[model samples]
Target: MARKYQRANRMNWLMPVLFALPLLCLAGAALLLWGDQLRDLINIAVKLAVIS
Candidate 1:
Protein backbone atom coordinates (compact mmCIF):
# COMPACT_ATOMS: atom_id res chain seq x y z
CA MET A 1 0.00 0.00 0.00
CA ALA A 2 2.81 2.37 0.87
CA ARG A 3 4.65 1.63 -2.39
CA LYS A 4 1.50 2.20 -4.39
CA TYR A 5 0.93 5.50 -2.67
CA GLN A 6 4.47 6.58 -3.41
CA ARG A 7 4.13 5.57 -7.02
CA ALA A 8 0.94 7.54 -7.38
CA ASN A 9 2.60 10.55 -5.82
CA ARG A 10 5.38 10.35 -8.39
CA MET A 11 2.92 9.98 -11.21
CA ASN A 12 0.83 12.90 -10.03
CA TRP A 13 3.69 15.24 -10.83
CA LEU A 14 4.70 13.39 -14.01
CA MET A 15 1.32 12.70 -15.54
CA PRO A 16 0.55 16.21 -16.80
CA VAL A 17 3.97 16.58 -18.42
CA LEU A 18 3.65 13.15 -20.02
CA PHE A 19 0.22 14.02 -21.37
CA ALA A 20 1.39 17.37 -22.74
CA LEU A 21 4.49 16.00 -24.46
CA PRO A 22 2.63 14.62 -27.44
CA LEU A 23 0.80 17.91 -27.98
CA LEU A 24 4.08 19.83 -27.82
CA CYS A 25 5.62 17.42 -30.31
CA LEU A 26 2.67 17.82 -32.65
CA ALA A 27 2.94 21.62 -32.54
CA GLY A 28 6.67 21.44 -33.20
CA ALA A 29 6.09 19.16 -36.13
CA ALA A 30 3.47 21.51 -37.52
CA LEU A 31 5.82 24.49 -37.20
CA LEU A 32 8.52 22.61 -39.04
CA LEU A 33 6.14 21.50 -41.77
CA TRP A 34 4.42 24.85 -42.28
CA GLY A 35 7.28 27.18 -41.48
CA ASP A 36 7.95 28.32 -45.02
CA GLN A 37 4.31 29.02 -45.80
CA LEU A 38 3.90 30.91 -42.55
CA ARG A 39 6.91 33.03 -43.30
CA ASP A 40 5.55 33.95 -46.69
CA LEU A 41 2.18 34.86 -45.19
CA ILE A 42 3.78 37.09 -42.63
CA ASN A 43 5.83 38.89 -45.24
CA ILE A 44 2.77 39.52 -47.33
CA ALA A 45 0.88 40.85 -44.33
CA VAL A 46 3.75 43.13 -43.49
CA LYS A 47 3.97 44.46 -47.02
CA LEU A 48 0.24 45.16 -47.05
CA ALA A 49 0.42 46.87 -43.70
CA VAL A 50 3.24 49.10 -44.86
CA ILE A 51 1.43 49.97 -48.11
CA SER A 52 -1.82 50.82 -46.32
Candidate 2:
Protein backbone atom coordinates (compact mmCIF):
# COMPACT_ATOMS: atom_id res chain seq x y z
CA MET A 1 0.00 0.00 0.00
CA ALA A 2 2.75 2.46 0.91
CA ARG A 3 4.70 1.40 -2.16
CA LYS A 4 1.70 2.03 -4.39
CA TYR A 5 1.25 5.48 -2.88
CA GLN A 6 4.89 6.25 -3.49
CA ARG A 7 4.63 5.09 -7.09
CA ALA A 8 1.61 7.31 -7.64
CA ASN A 9 3.47 10.27 -6.25
CA ARG A 10 6.42 9.56 -8.48
CA MET A 11 4.21 9.24 -11.54
CA ASN A 12 2.55 12.57 -10.77
CA TRP A 13 5.91 14.23 -10.57
CA LEU A 14 7.14 12.47 -13.70
CA MET A 15 4.22 13.35 -15.98
CA PRO A 16 4.82 17.09 -15.86
CA VAL A 17 8.53 16.64 -16.35
CA LEU A 18 7.94 14.34 -19.31
CA PHE A 19 5.52 16.76 -20.94
CA ALA A 20 7.93 19.63 -20.34
CA LEU A 21 10.74 17.74 -22.07
CA PRO A 22 9.24 18.29 -25.51
CA LEU A 23 8.78 21.99 -24.86
CA LEU A 24 12.38 22.17 -23.71
CA CYS A 25 13.50 20.55 -26.95
CA LEU A 26 11.44 23.04 -28.95
CA ALA A 27 12.93 25.92 -26.98
CA GLY A 28 16.40 24.59 -27.60
CA ALA A 29 15.71 24.38 -31.31
CA ALA A 30 14.46 27.96 -31.35
CA LEU A 31 17.53 29.05 -29.44
CA LEU A 32 19.74 27.36 -31.97
CA LEU A 33 17.98 29.13 -34.81
CA TRP A 34 18.27 32.47 -33.05
CA GLY A 35 21.95 32.03 -32.16
CA ASP A 36 23.41 32.33 -28.66
CA GLN A 37 22.76 35.93 -27.73
CA LEU A 38 21.06 37.91 -24.96
CA ARG A 39 17.89 37.99 -27.00
CA ASP A 40 17.91 34.23 -27.35
CA LEU A 41 18.44 33.81 -23.62
CA ILE A 42 15.56 36.09 -22.80
CA ASN A 43 13.33 34.38 -25.33
CA ILE A 44 14.14 30.94 -23.98
CA ALA A 45 13.60 32.08 -20.40
CA VAL A 46 10.27 33.61 -21.26
CA LYS A 47 9.19 30.55 -23.19
CA LEU A 48 10.13 28.22 -20.34
CA ALA A 49 8.42 30.41 -17.77
CA VAL A 50 5.24 30.59 -19.79
CA ILE A 51 5.18 26.85 -20.47
CA SER A 52 5.83 25.96 -16.85
Candidate 3:
Protein backbone atom coordinates (compact mmCIF):
# COMPACT_ATOMS: atom_id res chain seq x y z
CA MET A 1 0.00 0.00 0.00
CA ALA A 2 2.77 2.40 0.92
CA ARG A 3 4.67 1.39 -2.23
CA LYS A 4 1.66 2.02 -4.35
CA TYR A 5 1.09 5.36 -2.73
CA GLN A 6 4.70 6.30 -3.28
CA ARG A 7 4.53 5.25 -6.91
CA ALA A 8 1.40 7.23 -7.44
CA ASN A 9 3.07 10.26 -5.93
CA ARG A 10 6.08 9.80 -8.15
CA MET A 11 3.92 9.43 -11.20
CA ASN A 12 2.04 12.57 -10.35
CA TRP A 13 5.28 14.53 -10.36
CA LEU A 14 6.80 12.70 -13.27
CA MET A 15 3.82 12.89 -15.61
CA PRO A 16 3.76 16.66 -15.92
CA VAL A 17 7.49 16.92 -16.42
CA LEU A 18 7.44 14.21 -19.06
CA PHE A 19 4.65 15.97 -20.93
CA ALA A 20 6.28 19.38 -20.59
CA LEU A 21 9.65 18.24 -21.90
CA PRO A 22 8.31 17.71 -25.39
CA LEU A 23 6.50 21.01 -25.29
CA LEU A 24 9.75 22.68 -24.32
CA CYS A 25 11.55 20.99 -27.18
CA LEU A 26 8.89 22.09 -29.65
CA ALA A 27 9.16 25.67 -28.42
CA GLY A 28 12.93 25.54 -28.84
CA ALA A 29 12.63 24.16 -32.36
CA ALA A 30 10.12 26.88 -33.26
CA LEU A 31 12.46 29.55 -31.94
CA LEU A 32 15.38 28.15 -33.92
CA LEU A 33 13.37 27.81 -37.14
CA TRP A 34 11.42 31.08 -36.94
CA GLY A 35 13.83 33.28 -35.05
CA ASP A 36 14.33 35.55 -38.02
CA GLN A 37 10.61 36.08 -38.41
CA LEU A 38 10.33 36.73 -34.69
CA ARG A 39 13.12 39.25 -34.96
CA ASP A 40 11.33 41.01 -37.78
CA LEU A 41 8.19 41.17 -35.69
CA ILE A 42 10.12 42.71 -32.83
CA ASN A 43 11.62 45.29 -35.15
CA ILE A 44 8.19 46.17 -36.49
CA ALA A 45 6.85 46.48 -32.98
CA VAL A 46 9.72 48.71 -32.02
CA LYS A 47 9.14 50.93 -35.01
CA LEU A 48 5.47 51.21 -34.19
CA ALA A 49 6.31 52.04 -30.62
CA VAL A 50 8.68 54.75 -31.74
CA ILE A 51 6.08 56.19 -34.05
CA SER A 52 3.51 56.23 -31.32
Candidate 4:
Protein backbone atom coordinates (compact mmCIF):
# COMPACT_ATOMS: atom_id res chain seq x y z
CA MET A 1 0.00 0.00 0.00
CA ALA A 2 2.83 2.39 0.85
CA ARG A 3 4.58 1.50 -2.39
CA LYS A 4 1.47 2.12 -4.38
CA TYR A 5 1.00 5.47 -2.67
CA GLN A 6 4.57 6.40 -3.49
CA ARG A 7 4.11 5.52 -7.12
CA ALA A 8 0.94 7.58 -7.26
CA ASN A 9 2.70 10.53 -5.68
CA ARG A 10 5.49 10.33 -8.20
CA MET A 11 3.08 10.20 -11.07
CA ASN A 12 1.11 13.18 -9.69
CA TRP A 13 4.14 15.42 -10.01
CA LEU A 14 5.17 13.95 -13.34
CA MET A 15 1.77 14.15 -15.01
CA PRO A 16 1.63 17.94 -15.14
CA VAL A 17 5.12 18.08 -16.60
CA LEU A 18 4.15 15.53 -19.24
CA PHE A 19 1.09 17.58 -20.14
CA ALA A 20 3.06 20.84 -20.25
CA LEU A 21 5.82 19.46 -22.44
CA PRO A 22 3.77 19.75 -25.61
CA LEU A 23 2.69 23.29 -24.75
CA LEU A 24 6.30 24.23 -24.11
CA CYS A 25 7.33 22.74 -27.42
CA LEU A 26 4.68 24.73 -29.23
CA ALA A 27 5.79 27.94 -27.48
CA GLY A 28 9.38 27.24 -28.50
CA ALA A 29 8.37 26.69 -32.10
CA ALA A 30 6.38 29.94 -32.06
CA LEU A 31 9.36 31.83 -30.64
CA LEU A 32 11.60 30.41 -33.30
CA LEU A 33 9.14 31.35 -36.00
CA TRP A 34 8.69 34.91 -34.69
CA GLY A 35 12.12 35.52 -33.20
CA ASP A 36 12.75 38.45 -35.51
CA GLN A 37 9.53 40.16 -34.44
CA LEU A 38 10.38 39.54 -30.81
CA ARG A 39 13.77 41.07 -31.29
CA ASP A 40 12.25 44.07 -32.99
CA LEU A 41 9.81 44.54 -30.09
CA ILE A 42 12.67 44.31 -27.62
CA ASN A 43 14.65 46.86 -29.53
CA ILE A 44 11.72 49.23 -29.59
CA ALA A 45 11.18 48.79 -25.88
CA VAL A 46 14.83 49.48 -25.16
CA LYS A 47 14.82 52.59 -27.30
CA LEU A 48 11.70 53.86 -25.52
CA ALA A 49 13.20 53.14 -22.15
CA VAL A 50 16.40 54.92 -23.05
CA ILE A 51 14.49 57.89 -24.35
CA SER A 52 12.51 58.11 -21.10
Candidate 5:
Protein backbone atom coordinates (compact mmCIF):
# COMPACT_ATOMS: atom_id res chain seq x y z
CA MET A 1 0.00 0.00 0.00
CA ALA A 2 2.76 2.42 0.91
CA ARG A 3 4.65 1.54 -2.28
CA LYS A 4 1.59 2.23 -4.38
CA TYR A 5 1.16 5.60 -2.71
CA GLN A 6 4.81 6.43 -3.36
CA ARG A 7 4.51 5.43 -7.00
CA ALA A 8 1.43 7.59 -7.45
CA ASN A 9 3.18 10.56 -5.87
CA ARG A 10 6.16 10.17 -8.17
CA MET A 11 3.97 9.95 -11.23
CA ASN A 12 2.10 13.14 -10.33
CA TRP A 13 5.22 15.24 -10.80
CA LEU A 14 6.61 13.15 -13.66
CA MET A 15 3.43 13.40 -15.73
CA PRO A 16 3.63 17.15 -16.24
CA VAL A 17 7.30 16.95 -17.30
CA LEU A 18 6.49 14.18 -19.77
CA PHE A 19 3.65 16.24 -21.21
CA ALA A 20 5.77 19.40 -21.39
CA LEU A 21 8.76 17.84 -23.16
CA PRO A 22 7.03 17.67 -26.53
CA LEU A 23 5.64 21.19 -26.21
CA LEU A 24 9.09 22.51 -25.35
CA CYS A 25 10.56 20.76 -28.38
CA LEU A 26 7.91 22.30 -30.60
CA ALA A 27 8.59 25.79 -29.24
CA GLY A 28 12.32 25.35 -29.78
CA ALA A 29 11.75 24.27 -33.36
CA ALA A 30 9.52 27.29 -33.95
CA LEU A 31 12.15 29.68 -32.59
CA LEU A 32 14.84 28.12 -34.70
CA LEU A 33 12.70 28.47 -37.83
CA TRP A 34 11.49 32.04 -37.17
CA GLY A 35 14.20 33.54 -35.00
CA ASP A 36 15.03 36.25 -37.53
CA GLN A 37 11.40 37.20 -37.94
CA LEU A 38 10.98 37.42 -34.17
CA ARG A 39 14.01 39.65 -33.89
CA ASP A 40 12.68 41.97 -36.57
CA LEU A 41 9.34 42.22 -34.82
CA ILE A 42 11.01 43.08 -31.54
CA ASN A 43 13.12 45.75 -33.16
CA ILE A 44 10.08 47.30 -34.78
CA ALA A 45 8.23 47.37 -31.48
CA VAL A 46 11.19 48.98 -29.76
CA LYS A 47 11.48 51.62 -32.42
CA LEU A 48 7.78 52.45 -32.13
CA ALA A 49 8.12 52.72 -28.38
CA VAL A 50 11.05 55.13 -28.68
CA ILE A 51 9.22 57.25 -31.21
CA SER A 52 6.18 57.55 -28.93
Candidate 6:
Protein backbone atom coordinates (compact mmCIF):
# COMPACT_ATOMS: atom_id res chain seq x y z
CA MET A 1 0.00 0.00 0.00
CA ALA A 2 2.80 2.39 0.89
CA ARG A 3 4.67 1.67 -2.37
CA LYS A 4 1.52 2.19 -4.40
CA TYR A 5 0.97 5.54 -2.76
CA GLN A 6 4.53 6.58 -3.53
CA ARG A 7 4.22 5.52 -7.16
CA ALA A 8 1.03 7.50 -7.55
CA ASN A 9 2.69 10.52 -6.02
CA ARG A 10 5.51 10.35 -8.55
CA MET A 11 3.13 9.90 -11.44
CA ASN A 12 1.00 12.84 -10.29
CA TRP A 13 3.98 15.12 -10.79
CA LEU A 14 5.13 13.47 -13.99
CA MET A 15 1.81 12.96 -15.76
CA PRO A 16 1.17 16.57 -16.61
CA VAL A 17 4.57 16.99 -18.24
CA LEU A 18 4.16 13.78 -20.21
CA PHE A 19 0.73 14.86 -21.41
CA ALA A 20 2.03 18.30 -22.38
CA LEU A 21 4.96 17.12 -24.46
CA PRO A 22 3.02 16.92 -27.72
CA LEU A 23 1.56 20.40 -27.34
CA LEU A 24 5.02 21.75 -26.56
CA CYS A 25 6.41 20.14 -29.70
CA LEU A 26 3.61 21.56 -31.82
CA ALA A 27 4.17 25.03 -30.41
CA GLY A 28 7.88 24.79 -31.14
CA ALA A 29 7.22 23.72 -34.71
CA ALA A 30 4.79 26.57 -35.26
CA LEU A 31 7.21 29.07 -33.85
CA LEU A 32 9.99 27.91 -36.14
CA LEU A 33 7.74 27.96 -39.20
CA TRP A 34 6.31 31.44 -38.60
CA GLY A 35 8.73 33.17 -36.30
CA ASP A 36 10.60 35.09 -39.02
CA GLN A 37 7.40 36.33 -40.60
CA LEU A 38 6.21 37.48 -37.21
CA ARG A 39 9.39 39.34 -36.32
CA ASP A 40 12.38 41.20 -37.74
CA LEU A 41 15.20 38.72 -38.17
CA ILE A 42 18.56 38.61 -39.85
CA ASN A 43 20.64 35.75 -41.14
CA ILE A 44 24.25 35.42 -40.20
CA ALA A 45 26.80 36.05 -42.94
CA VAL A 46 29.95 34.03 -43.29
CA LYS A 47 33.08 35.41 -44.94
CA LEU A 48 35.58 33.31 -46.79
CA ALA A 49 38.91 34.49 -48.16
CA VAL A 50 41.12 32.66 -50.64
CA ILE A 51 44.73 32.14 -49.59
CA SER A 52 47.30 33.62 -51.97
lDDT of 3 by residue, 1-52 (tens): 9999998887887887898999899999999999899999999999988965
Clashes of each: 0, 0, 0, 0, 0, 0
lDDT of 1 at 37: 97
Give one digit per residue, the lDDT tens place, for model 1 in 1-52: 9999998888888888999999999999999999899999999999988965
In angstroms, give how far residue 38 of model 3 lies from its true place.
0.8
Reference-based TM-score, model 3: 0.55
Per TM-score, what order, best first?
1, 5, 3, 4, 6, 2
Cα error of candidate 3 at position 40, Å: 1.5
Clashing pairs in 2: none
lDDT scores of the candidates, listed in order: 0.93, 0.85, 0.92, 0.93, 0.93, 0.75
RMSD of 4: 3.8
TM-score of each: 0.67, 0.42, 0.55, 0.53, 0.57, 0.48
Error of 6 at 40 (Å): 4.9
lDDT per residue, candidate 6, 1-52, as tens digits? 9999998888888888989999999999988998886554323222233333
Estimate, for each residue in 1-52, the C-alpha lDDT of model 4 and write its tens digit.
9999999888887888899999999999999999899999999999988965
- Decide which is better by lDDT, 2 or 5: 5
- Tens digit of per-residue lDDT, candidate 5, span 1-52: 9999999988887888899999999999999999899999999999988965
Model 1 per-residue lDDT at 42: 99
| Candidate 5 all-Cα RMSD | 3.5
In Å, residue 1's CA in model 2 sits off its true spot by: 10
With candidate 6 superimposed using the best TM-score fit, by how many Å does residue 52's alpha carbon deviate from the native?
Answer: 50
Clashing residue pairs for model 5: none
Clashing residue pairs in candidate 4 are none
Tens digits of per-residue lDDT for model 2, 1-52: 9999998987887888898999999988987877668687898889988965
